[model samples]
Target: MKSFLYPNIHPPSFTWINAEKTQIEKVHEWIKPITNKSNPVECKTAEIIVLGVPLSRSSISVSGASEFPEAFRRSWRSFTTYNLEDDIDLSSMEILDAGDVPMHVTDIRKCHQNIIQASTALYNHFPASTICAIGGDHSITAMMVKGMHRAYPVKKIGILQFDTHFDLRDLSDNGPSNGTPMRNLIESGDVNGTDMYNIGLHGFFNSQDLKNYADEKGVHYFTLRQMRKAGVRETVHQCLEELSSKVDVIYLTVDMDVLDIAYAPGVPASTPGGMTTEELLEGVLEAGKHPSVMSMDIVCLDPLKDAHAQPTVKLGTHVFLTFLTGVMLRKV
Candidate 1:
């Protein structure tokens, strides 16, 4: 196998807190950081590989989303990896935090290329490994999806996008912004538009033009109101069942703005009404455990916009753990 060139760009280093012995039994204790270069075999042997992509230059509006990975890592230190509901402790799993991708400040194209290299490297390193990527912004999803398609060319890839916006706008004039990733993916043929399923699309937050374009392109979508009417769980089950039948593998991309502004005020495009945090968690866990789901990402958490209480940061970290728990419990 060709080894991936690890980017030389500088990003935040993973910092392990020196918590008191009494508080050592948290999720921080479970997450093992891959700070140094490891043997190729060692990298390939991990059950789960977590990587951070810290580029936010194409924010479309708000900036500082690049700081999300570090903020989420910091918040994760305060939680426990053990799931009380599932009665499972994830500390035993072989999980590796592969650190953030080296970001380019001036060249957005270079930053996106680095993301593709990182994703391809991580995915190709292991035959059975599932990846969980922390985002700089939703635009990175275009590169991640492209990377995955490159890594597994034979399989048909399905995308499950959890967000408040369709993100299918044309960016021909502005370059590649976060609002244009899905459109780019469809146009590039990395993933078919019909294979893309979007949930929690909020009213007023998305324009009629985007909705019409999505429908015209055959992108499967459901609004927050539609989801509420059908019940979130049932709505997800219905979508997942139909989606799974059409594609060989599923890649889940979560945009934090999917949640109500009250729940995720830190997101760049957050609005007044949206899905509840619990609804997103349940849907993510359900999808993570499915046989067809191979990789996932949570995007658009701008730490600068977070509340003094840091509720959005806390929720983002918790969602990562929740998805991991579901993956850990998957049947062989």
Candidate 2:
């Protein structure tokens, strides 16, 4: 793993604050950084393995999303491993932060290939762990899911995509951008469209042709209005129930643009009328507790575009923690 891994550490912005935590109760105690080379880590023994992939060169829009992982670490120090609302403590959980994936500067294709290799290696080596990835763009998710498929060919994998756009853009004229991941996955036979489900799809970001493609491919989706009308909890429960029965495992990929722009304007494609922070959290929580969920990712957010305090990054981090909160309940 060290051959492909880059060391991760607490950002200087909050190191002083984190120092206080390292002393006693560890106020900002979160994941254990796998920073040692001599002391090799066995990833499969951990309950959760978190990895960062900072490859945003493939986004269709101009982006600084590659900085998201470090920003997340900074925000991570502001919070704790305890969920006050649920009275759950994650400090004892064997979670390994294996650090960020080494990415190519100008080679998008190379980056994707490396991501696939990293994902396959992680999933293959850590088959017993829940692999949670932090992405540089939605494109990385395609590679992540594909990697999982490569690692475990016999397992029927399902996708739970929470986003506004269909992410099925035609790539005849374009390269492998974030918009084309799902299409590539579907066309390459890496995943079956019948096993995929999209939630929080709203706004007019997608086209009729894309809708036709989705319908023809048998992809399941729920519009923002549809989920709201049916109730977030009920709709998500329905999706999980249907997909879990059909597939051996589910992989959740959350595009931050699914969030309302007011809550997450950092994402290039985010818009109004998308899911609220609370709504998205509820859906993620549901996925976290499901026995079939093997992996998950949060993507499409650029920290550079966020507010002065970077609320969107912070909120995204919260979404990550909320997912883990639900995961803790599964133990009970």
Candidate 3:
């Protein structure tokens, strides 16, 4: 893996949102195993570790998502208990709240570099561990993939992006931003563009230019309409089978906007008539179960827009927990 320059970035302060004193008390009871005494716990040996990269930059989300990491942590306090069906105890696992990566909101380049630095450190430290990254925005996907590429240079990396938009805009003039993550990843040369696959793309919002670009790059894509026509199970099965043949390591990136606006109104960009929360959960869980999945990122959640905060926090927890269950089952 390539060495990063900013290894000395300060750790993030845990600022919980909407958490009452009693709620925090209950959360701390179970989270003790994950958090450190002086600092948050750093898992030395664990099959999986959840790292919070709450990087909120104005360039990424128009409403700002830097506050998501703290809000998510607070919401997790209520839902962190073990599940009997999965027969897995999260507290028993080598899970750690590595905290958020520091970012210079004024300098977009510096922020991207910081993400690369932090993700690269984690990848190198735990080569075998599955990384569950809590995102700042969809743009962070580019840096995370770059870090993974550095860690496993020989592995053929594939990106499975669950989003409504194509995110293939080549913004050469503006540089890389949240809307241009996929384009930047393809241009980076670390990942094979042909091996990339995007799911949940709906019509009307997507243009022919984006489709042409995807076709030109040999990127595999599936629309929500097509998935509805073929049924979710068959669609997901075909996607996995096709991607498995093209790449050795698969990284899944889920943009909350992929869900219908009614289901995920807290995202920066909400599209109507998209996948439902239940369908997304099922599809993502199935994808996570695949042996090729190495790491995953969930992004574009805005708590401010979420009335009662359930849409952003609860949905985020649901996705994370489902993925965790899938990973545990894969081991068995």
The residue-by-residue lDDT of candidate 1 on 1-332, one tens digit each, is: 11233452233356565545543367777666664454667767788877888878988886788998888888876788778998887877777777788877799998988888877777777658888889889999999888888888888988998998899998785567899989989989888899999989876877888889998999999988888898877877787788899999889899998998988889888888888888999988887777778889989999999989788989998888888888887853
List the lowest-lDDT window of 10 residues for candidate 2.
7-16
lDDT of 3: 0.74
Tens-digit lDDT track for model 3 on 1-332? 11121342344446333433443223334442233343322355666756666665734448556667667777766675565666765554445455567778589788888888878877887788888788778788888888888777788888888899888887774478777888898888877678888889985877798789989988888889888888766777677778789888888898888999999878888779889987888888788778888799888888877877466668977787777777766867
Pairs of colliding residues, candidate 1: none
For candidate 2, write residues 1-332 as lDDT tens digits.
Answer: 34224322121222223343533333246566654442445545788888788878899998888888878877776787778888988776777676777777788888888888888877877888999988789999889988899999999888999989899998785567899888888988988989889998887888999999999999999999999999988888888899999999999999999999998989877788889998999999888988888799999889999988899999889888888887888888
Leading candidate by TM-score: 1
Candidate 3 differs from the real structure by a C-alpha RMSD in angstroms, to one decimal, of 4.5
Which should have the higher lDDT, number 1 or number 3?
1
Regions more than 4 Å wrong, model 1? 1-5, 8-12, 17-24
- lDDT (0-100) at residue 1 of candidate 3? 12
Displacement of residue 7 (Cα, Å) in model 3 is 4.2
Give the per-residue Cα lDDT of candidate 3 at 53.
67
Q: Candidate 1, 262: how far from true, in Å?
A: 0.7
What does the lDDT come to for candidate 2?
0.82
User: Number of clashing pairs, model 1?
Assistant: 0
